[model samples]
Target: MNRFILLFALCFHPFALIAQQPVPVKPRILISTDIGGTDPDDNQSMAHLLMYNDKFNIEGLVSSPSYGSGTKGEILRMIDLYEQDLPKLKAHRNGFLSPAYLRSVTKQGRRGNAPYRGYSKATEGSDWIIKCAKKKSDQPLWVLGWGGLEDIAQALHDAPEIQSKLRVYWIGGPNKKWGANSYAYIAENFPGLWFIEVNSSYYGFFSNNNILDSVKTTDYYDKYIQGAGYLGKDFKSYYNGEVKMGDTPSLLYMMDGNPENPARESWGGSFEHLSRSPHVVFNSATRITDTVAFCTVVEFNLKGPEIVIPQDSVCFWMETPYKNAVQKWPGYYLGKGRYGLKYVPKQAEIVSYRFRSSIPNVDFGEGKLTVTNHWPGKVNNTDYKLGANWYSDKADPALYEGKIQGGKTLSKWRQSVLTDWAARWGWLKK
Candidate 1:
C-alpha cells in the first residue's frame, strides 16, 4: 500500500509542475508608414522601422498607396533598398549567398533565408508580412497605415494563415459623408484583420498639413539633384521653378513617412469649432430623400481621439474665423451646403484620450490613427530611439548631397538622402 501510494504521488507531481509553468509573453509593436512607391516619406518610415529594431520585433511593413507604384512595388523597393543600401557592419553584414533576415538583429534565430534565392537585393516584404503574423498569437500586432491600403490587403491575400494574428490601424478612406472607394477592396476581402480608418474631416482625424506651401522650392533645390542623386537635376530643376507641378502626395507618401523634423510629427482630427458647437454653422452634406440613407451618423467608443461629423451639424463655416477650419467638412456635396442637423440618437460626450507621454501631437496625415493608452507610456521612451530621424532635420534638400560623401555606403547614402528629404517635407519626426 505504501509503495503504491508513493507511485501515485510521483505520477501526479509532474502534472502539477507543468500546470505551474508560466506562459511566454509576446512582443508589442506600432508601425508608422509613408508607403506606395519609393518616395521620401516611405523612406523615412523605413528608416523609422530599421532604427527601432529592438522595441518592435517588427513583424513586417505594409506598403500603402501614397508613394506611387502601389503596394507590391513599394514593399519590394523598400526591401530592396534595405538590402542594398543600409550599411552592414562587420558582424551584421550578410554576403550574397545568405537567406533573408526577418527578425530583429539581436534575436538568436536571426539568419539569412537559405531557401529564397531570388530575394537577391529584394526586400522580401511579402515573406516578412506572412512570417511576422505567424510568429505569435496572443499579442496584438499594431500596423499604422498613414497612406494607401495596398500592402495590408496584399499581406492578407498572400498569407491567409496569419490573418487572425494581426490588426491594422489606417488613416484614409472617404469620410462618413462620402462613400469610400468601391474598387479598393482590401479590408472587405480579409475580414480577419481589424481595420480602423481615421477620417480627416472628422474632428479627431490627423492631418498632413500642406507644409510644402510653407517653404520655397528654390530654397533647397539643386542641393542633391546632381550625379548619383535619386531624382536627378532635371527632376529638381523642373520642381524648383513655378514651371514644375511638384510630385504627387501619393509618391511622397510611399517613399518616406514624414518630410520634416521628427519632432514636427502631425496627428488627425479637426476641432477648430468645438468651442461654439450648436451656434456654429456645422455643415451636413447628407443627400437622402427616401429609403436609402448614406448620411447616418455611426458612433463607437474611441480608445483614442476621433473627429466627429455630428448629425446635427450645420454648414456654418462658410466664412469668418472658422474659414480655414471648416472648408471641407466630410459628408457634404461640393456646391451644395448644409440643410439641417445630422444626429446620432444615443450619442453622448466627445472624448479624447492620448497615451500618457507620447510625442504630443505627431501627425501622419489623414489615414493614420493612434490608439490611446494601449501600452504604458514608458514604451514610448524605450522605443524612442527607433523613431529618431537618421537624417538632418534642416529643411534643405542640399543636405542630401552633402551627407553622401560622409563615409556612407551606397545603401546608407541612399537612405540618408531620402531621409533628409523626407524630414524636410514633414513625413518623419526629428
Candidate 2:
C-alpha cells in the first residue's frame, strides 16, 4: 500500500494499537431515575445503562420519579428483563452484574418534588444515597441525577458530610421544573460540591445532528435493537423504539476517557465551568414580555391582598405551562404581599403563570416571563469559569438548531457513540 494510504488505514483500523484505549478502572455510580414517568426517556436510558452494566461499578438504582407514575416496580420490571437476558449478556461480556444484585441495591425515592424547605422526610432511596456515599472507596460516588434532585437533596440535608464524597451530573432541563425546591436547596447549601448540571446539553443525544441518517435516533433502534434480545425487544414500547436516551450522557461521560475531567473531549460532550448559577429577582408581578435565565431562580415579590398571616402562613401557588401540560408549584408564600415566592423555569419557553392563593382573603395574580438560554437576563456571561468543579453548557453555538446551545459538543460525537452501541446489539442475542 502507498505510505499515505497505510497511515490512514492504521489510524482508522478498529483493532489498531493506537486505536485501543487502556482499560479504565470502573467508576462507582448511583443513578436516580424516573423510569416509568410521563416521558419514557428514562426507561430508554436505563435500558442502555443495563446493557453496558459491565463498564461501571453500579452501586445504586433508585426510582425517583419527580413527576408522572414512575415507581420501584417499574425499575424492577427492567431488572426482570435484564435477568431474562443476562445469560446472553454474559456470553458476550464476562463482568455483567447479576440481576439479583441490581435489584438488591434498588430503592424507592420520594414520590414527588421536595417541599418548600427543599427536603421532606428521608426515603429509602435517600438513605441508600447516604449509605453508598459513606462507603469506603477510592472513587468518588458519581450520582447521576436522572430525574428529580429530591433524594439527593434529602441525602445531603440528612448528611452534609457526604457532600465532599459526591460528584453530581444532573439532567436538569424540564426535570428541573419538577423539583425546583430540591435543586435550589442543593445549589444554595452545597455550592462547593463538584457538580455538572447539564440542562440542555443532554438533548444532544437524541436531537438532530450531522451523523449518518441510519445511525440517527429514528433509525438506529430498528436496525440494531428490534431483534436483539429481551431488553432490546422491550425497548420498542418506550418512545416507539426510537433512541431518546437524554439521561445517558452521564453514563457516556464516564463510559470512555477520564471520568474525572469534564472539560476533556469524550463520547459525552465537554462542558464549561461556572462559579455561580444565575439568580434573578422580580419586585412586582412579571409580564409575559419579561425574560429570565433558564434553570435560574427567579424570585418574585408582589404586593397582593394585604391581609397578613403568622409569618406568611398562607400558601401561594402558581400554575405554569410545560410541554403541553400545566404544572403548578405549590406553597410559595408571596401572598402576604411579600417577596417569598421564587420559581425556576425548566426550559427556554415563555413561562406564563397564574397565582392562586389557598387562603380566601389572598387573591390571584397572573403574568408571563420569556425564558432564554443566557445565564443572566439581557446578556450572556463570558466569565463562566468557577473555583469549584461546576460544569454546564456554553452559551455559544458552533452548531445551531434554533438558537445558541452547547449541545453541538456532544452531538459531534454521536456517530461514534451510536456505531459502538449498534455493534453491541449483537451481544444481546449471542
Candidate 3:
C-alpha cells in the first residue's frame, strides 16, 4: 500500500519537484534609442544602462533618431566605453554583457521621423525587432522607445503576429511630437498592445524640483561617477558633466517590480492607464514642455546701496505679452518676503516682458525684463497635472489632480530612482 501511494504522488505531483528548483527571473529588454542625436541626454542614459546591465537581459540596441539623427557608430562608441569599464563593473557585480556581444546586437533604424502614416520602408533595425519578438521565451520582449517609435511601428506593420509578444514603454513628450504619425498608427491600430507613454515622469530624473542640491550640481559627479571608471569617464564628458539620464527610468521600472505587471510600484516610478488612445495634450501642464516653453524665475534681494527706503513696501510687476494681448502675471511672496513670479509663454514666437516695482525704492536688478525670440511649443492651458497616472488608466482619476494614492508622491519616486542609481554605482550598500 505504501509503495503504491508513493508512485501515485510522484506521478500526480511532478511539477511540485520541478518548482522547488529556483528559477532565475530576468526581464528581457531591447533599447531603441537616438543616442547621437540633438539631445545628449540619451547618451547619458545609455551609460547608466550599461553600468547596471546585469539587472536585465538586454537583447538589442538600435539607433532610431527622431528629431535630429543617430547612427550605429555612436552606439559602438559607448559600447567601447563599456568594454573598458567591464572589468571594474564585473568586480562589483556579475552578468555584465561583453562588449563584443553588445556590438553584435547594435543596429541602425530609421534616421528621421516617420511620415503621416507612421512607417517607411523596412530597415535593418525594424527587421531585427520583429526577429527578436518571435523568439521562444516565457518573458515578454520590452521595447523601450527612447527616441522615435518608427522602427517599432515598422516592425509591427511587417509582422503583426508578434504583437502579443511585445510590451512598449515610449519616452514621449517631445519625442512624441517628433513621431506623432507613427505613435498614432500604433495606438489606433494596436488597442490590445501594452504601452506606457512616459512624457513627464522621466523628467523627474533631471528636474530641479525633486533632486537634492548636493546631487544636482557637482557633488554627485565628483563623488560616484567622474573618475570612477571607464563608464564614469565617458559619462562625465557628456552634457558638460550633468547627471541627466532621462531615459534610464524606463529600464529602472523593469528592474524592481514584476515586469509582467507595470502597475506595481517600482524604482522607475508608477503609471496609470490612458482614458483614450495616447495623445499629446497640447498647451497643457499634463506633460513636461520642451526647453522652448520653460519659465525662468529670477529673485532679487533688496539690500545695500540699492535700498532707498527700508520701510517702503515693494511690489514687483511682471508683464507677459501673448499674441495681440499682454497680461500681468501674478507675483507671489516666496517666504521671507522675497519677490518671484512664473509665467509660461502662450505663443511659439518670441515673448517680450517688462518688470517694474510699484515702490521707487525697489530696483529691477541687473538686466531689464527681456524675453528672447524663442518658440514655446505647447503651453499649459488646463491645471491638469502630470503624474504616474498620466499613462495609465488603471489608476484612479483623482490622482491626476495631484492627490496621493498608495502613499506615492513624485518626490518619493524620484528618491527611489536616485537610491537605485547610487546602489548600482557602488555609492550605496546593496
Candidate 4:
C-alpha cells in the first residue's frame, strides 16, 4: 500500500520540484556582458554559468561594454576554458550545448556608451540580439544584461518589434553608473517591455545575514569552487577568490523560480512592478523650483532658430558640475524644429549646467536642477529608475548589515542557493 502511494505521488508529478508558474523546459537566454572590463566580477559570473549551462538554452553571448576595453575576445577566452571542461560537465548532465555553438553566437557590440540620444549604429552583437528575439518560439528570449544596455538599446532602436519578444534582467547598480545614457533611452522609449532592473537587490547575492561560514565570500570558493574544475580555477584568479558574482543573480532568478512572476520569492530576490518612472522634459533651462525625484531622467528639448551644420554628432554639448570639476555631455539634434539633451541626477542637490552648440547662435545658456529625495528610505541611490513593466527591489527592503532595498530578499536565501551550487561543484570533482 505504501509503495502504491509512493508510485501514485510520483505519477502526480515527474520532477520533484516545480516552478511558481509553468515555464519552458529550458528558458532561452542570451547574455550581454562587460566580461573584460574594469570589474572582474563578470568573469566570475561567466565561469559560474558555463559550469551550470545545462539548465538554460543559452542563445547569444554579446560584449556590450560602456566603459573599459571589454571585447568578444574575452568571451572567447572563457569559451576556451569551457571547451576544456566540457567533457567533465557533460558527464554530469546530458544535452549540454556545444562550445562551438556558443562561440558562433558570440559577437561584439557597441564599443562605448551611446550618445545622449541613447542609440547609435548597429553592431554584430545588437543584430544577433534582434535575430534571436525574433525567432518563432513560445518562450520569450531572456536577455541577461551584466553590464551596459548599449547593445540592447541599439537593438530595440533598430527593431522596436522585438520589445514584446524579449525579457531583460539588468544588474543595475555599478553598471547603471556607467550606462546611464543607454538606460535612460530604454526607460523612456520602451515602457511596456518585460524588464527586471535589479538596481540594489543584486547587492544581496554577495551579502547576507546569519549565513553559514562555508557560504561566505571569503570561504566559499576555497570550500566548493577552487578545486572544482577549469572554471573554478579561473574564478579564483579574480578578486582573490572572494565571490563577487554580481551578475549571477540574474542567472539565479531564471533558474530558481517562475521568472514570469517577479514578485514571487526566489533565489534571485523578489521585485515590485514599477508602473511609472520620473521622466520630465523641459523646453528651457530648469530651475531649483522645478523639482523632480532624485535619479530622475530629465530631458531638455530646445527649439532654436534654424541653422545648418555639417554633422549632427558634434553639433551640441552640455557642461555640468560633477564632483570637483565640470563634465561635458553631448546633446542631440532631433528634427522637426527641435534639439534635445537628457540628464539623470544622482543626488539630492541643486545642479547647475550650461549648453553650447557648434552652430554658434544656438545656445541653452545655463540651468539649475533641483533633485529631491523620493526613494521612501535612503538617499542618492543608483540612477536605475526605469519605466512601466519594469521590476525592481522594493523601496524598503529587508536590511542586511545596514543595507536594504531589495537586498535581503536574496540574502535570506543565500544558504540554500550556495548549498545547491556546492552539490553541482561536486560533479566536477574527480
Candidate 5:
C-alpha cells in the first residue's frame, strides 16, 4: 500500500511542479550613458555600473551628447572610446550617436549621414529604447539617461505604444524647472509615463566632494589606479590639462525621482489646488492637446503658485520613508543618507537607487540581475581586470604617499590600494 501511494504521488508531483512554475524571464535594460558631456561624475557612474552589472541585466549602452553645438563633440568623444576597448567591456556598441555626429565631432566635414565608421550602422538610441519599453513582461524596462533627453524624447514621440512598458529616470535640470527644455515634447510623447528627475545643485555637493564624508578624492585616486602608482604618471598627466568625469549621483536622482527632490517645484506657493501643468502645442497655444499631472509638494511653502524651499534644505518624502524609495531603484546607488527632507506621493512607485554594491546577484540567461528579494532571478560576474604593468614598485615614495594621504602630489599609493581591493574581491589577479 505504501509503495503504491509513493508511485502515485511521484507521478503527480511532476505535473504539480510544472503548474506552479515561475514566469518566463524578460530582457531587462538598455542603459544610455553620456560618456563625456560635462564632468567626471559620468566616469564614476560608469565604474559604479561596472561594479554592479552582475545585479542588473544591462542590455546595451547608448552614448548620448548634450544639445546645441556640443552634441557632436560629445558623440565624437564616445566614438573614440568605442573605437577602443571600452565598449567591449560593457558588451555593447554605440547607440544613437551617428556617423554624421562623428563627422561633426571630428570636424571631418562629410555632409549627409554617412555610414558610421568601423561598423555597418550605428544603432540609434531612439529605436532601442522603444523596443525595450514595449516588452510584454510585467516588469517595466528602466531607461537611465545621464545626458540630455533628446534621444529618449524623440523615441517616445515616435513610439507612444511603449508608454506603459517603460519608466524614464532623467538626471538633468534644476529645481522648479522640470520639463523646461522640452515640455511639449515630453507632454505629447510621454503622457502619464513615469518621469524621475535628479536635480543639479543638491547633487553636486555630495557626488563631487562630500559623499556623506565617506568617499573622498583620495579614495578615488587609490581605488582607480590599482597600486601601480599612476598618480604622477597617467592620471596627473591630465590634471591641469583637460580631463573630467560626469556626475553619477545626479544621474541617479533623475532615474529615481524622490518627491522630496523634485526638479520642478512651486517655489513659494501654498496648496490652494494643484496648479495646471501647461501643454505647449506645436510651439503654439492653439495646437495644445493634453492637460497632464501637476502635483503638490506639501509642507513646502508656496507663494502665488510658486513652490519654495531653503536653498540648503534637503527635500525627501515625509510619509513614504526613504528606505522604501531605495527598494524601488535597486542596483543603481552609491549609498543612502540619514538626514534629509522627505516627500511622498500616495500613488507612485517612489523608488531610490543605491550604488551597484547593495544587491546580491545571480546570472540571468542574457545578463545578470539583482532583483527584489521576493522574486526569482539569476546573477552574473561583473569583475574588472586591471593590468598591473601600469605600476612600478619603484616610484617616488614621498609623492605617492602624499597623494594617498591627501597631500600635494600624485603617486602610486592610490593605485596600490585600489588594486589590492580589486584583487581581494577577485576582480583582478593579485
Candidate 6:
C-alpha cells in the first residue's frame, strides 16, 4: 500500500511534473519592416534586433515599404553592418546567425501600398513567408509587421492553409492606414485569425518619459552603442545619432512571453482582444474646434543678492505659442511678478509655453495653470496628409482600457528593453 501511494504521488505531484519539462526559449521571429523609408527609425529598430540576434530564431527580413522610399538595398546595407559586428556579438553569446544566412533571407516585398483589396501580386517576400509558414516546425512563425501588412496579407491570400501555423503582430497605428486594403481583407475574411494589432501602445517605447537619467542622456548611447562595434556605429548614424528604435517592441514582446497568448504581459506592452475587425470600423472624424486656449503662470524669485531692475525695461519675455500664425492674445504681465498668455493653436497642436525673466538677481521658477476646452481626441487631417497618420474613426476602446500584466507602465517596459540591450552588449550577463 505504501508503494502504491508513492507511485501515485510521483505520477501526479506538480513539482515533479514541472521538473521534468524543459524550459522554453524565445519564439521563432520573421521581421517584415520598411527600413530605408522616409522615417529612419526602422533602421534603428533593425540594428537593435541584430544586436540581440542570439535571443531569437530569426527566419527572414523582408522590406515591405508602404509609403516611404525604401527597399531591399537598404536592408542589405544594414545587414552588412551586422556582418562586421557579428564576431564581437558572438564572443558574448552563441547562436548568432551567420550574416550570409541573413542576407540570403532578406527580400523585397511590394514597393508601395497594396491595392484597395490588399494583395496586389506575388512577390519574393510574400512567397517566402508562405514557404516559411508551411515548413514543419513545432513553433509558430511570428510575422512581425513593423512597416505594413501587405506582404503578410499576400501570404495569407496565396496560401490560406498556413493561416493556422502563423501568428501576426502588426504595429498598426499609421501603418494600418498605409495598408488599409490588405488589413481590411485580412480582417473581413479571417475573423478568427490569431493576430495582435498594436497601435498607441508601441508609442510607449519612445514616449516613456520615466527612463533612467543615464538612458535619457547621451552618455548611455556613447557607452553601450556608439563606437562599440560596427552595428553600434550604424545605429548611431540613424535618427540624427539618437537611440530611437521605435519598432523594437514587436520583438521584445516575443522575447520572453507566452507566444501562444499576446494578452499576457511581457517586455512588449500588453494588449486586449478586439471584438470586431478594426478595418471595418475605422473612419475619420471632422475637425470640430478651431482654437484652443492655454494658460500658465511664471514666477521670478529673487533669492540671492538683489540687483536693480530698470523700470519699463522688458522684465519677461515669452515666445508666441506654436502654430500661432493668428495670435488672439500674446504674453503680458499679470502683475505681482506673475505672467499669463492665451493664443489660438493650429490643428492638432502640441503646444508648450516658455518664458525667461530679465531680473538679474532672481531665478525664474515654474508655475502651473489649468487648461479648458482643449479637445483631447480632435483629429488633425493635416498630420494625415503629411504621412501615415490615419486614426480609426471608432477607435478600439480596448486599446485605452487594456492593461499590461503587473500593471506595468511604459517606463518599466522600456527598462526591460534597455536591460536586454545591455545584456547583448556584454555590459550585463544573460
* Candidate that scores best on TM-score: 2
**Root-mean-square deviation (CA) per prediction:** 22.2, 3.9, 16.6, 7.1, 22.9, 16.8
Question: Measured by TM-score, how close is model 4 to the native structure?
Answer: 0.79
Cα misplacement distance, residue 206 of candidate 6 (Å):
1.5
Candidate 5 lDDT trough over 10 residues, lowest sum: 266-275
The local distance difference test score of model 2 is 0.78
Q: Give the better candidate number (3 or 4) by TM-score.
A: 4
State the lDDT at 233 in candidate 2: 88
Tens-digit lDDT track for model 4 on 253-330? 888768888888777878888766666778998877888755566777888766554324556877887778877666
Candidate 5 lDDT over residue span 25-126, tens digit each: 422545555554334445445543443343354544565543212233443443443334233333432232332433331321111111101011223666
Superior by TM-score: candidate 2 or candidate 3: 2
Which sections of candidate 1 miss by over 4 Å? 1-40, 51-54, 62-68, 71-131, 150-164, 173-195, 201-430
lDDT string, candidate 6, 1-430, tens digits: 5998768655643222221112176678898998988778898888878877877888899999987888999989888988877777777778888889999999889888764445779899999999899889988898888987889889999998898888888777557645555676676666556787665566556653443323542344666665566766666677656666668778777775576655555566665555543111101111223222211111122223333443222344434343535211222343454333222222223334444555563333332223232212333232111111111112334333232111232334565466447656553222
TM accuracy, model 5? 0.40
Better of 5 and 6 by TM-score: 6
Ranking of all candidate structures by their lDDT, best first: 4, 2, 3, 6, 5, 1
Summarize candidate 3's per-residue lDDT along 1-430 as a digit string, tens digits: 5998768656753322222111148778899999999888888889888888887788999999966867888999999888876776777788889899999999999998765456778999999999899999988898988998899999999999998898888877557655655776676567667777665555555655433223453356776665566667677777777777778778777766565555665556567665453222222111122234212112223332233333322256556554588655433333343443334332123444565566565444322233222211234332223332225422343332132221231234554455456666663222
Candidate 1 per-residue lDDT, tens place, 206-315, comes to 11121322222333333332332222222343323221111122122222332121222112111111110011111222112211111112211112223244432222
lDDT for 22 in candidate 5 is 21
lDDT of 2 by residue, 204-308 (tens): 778764533336788777788979888898999987898888899988888868877888776677787877777666766788777777777776656555555
Ranking by TM-score: 2, 4, 6, 3, 5, 1
Q: What is the C-alpha lDDT of each candidate?
A: 0.29, 0.78, 0.62, 0.79, 0.33, 0.60
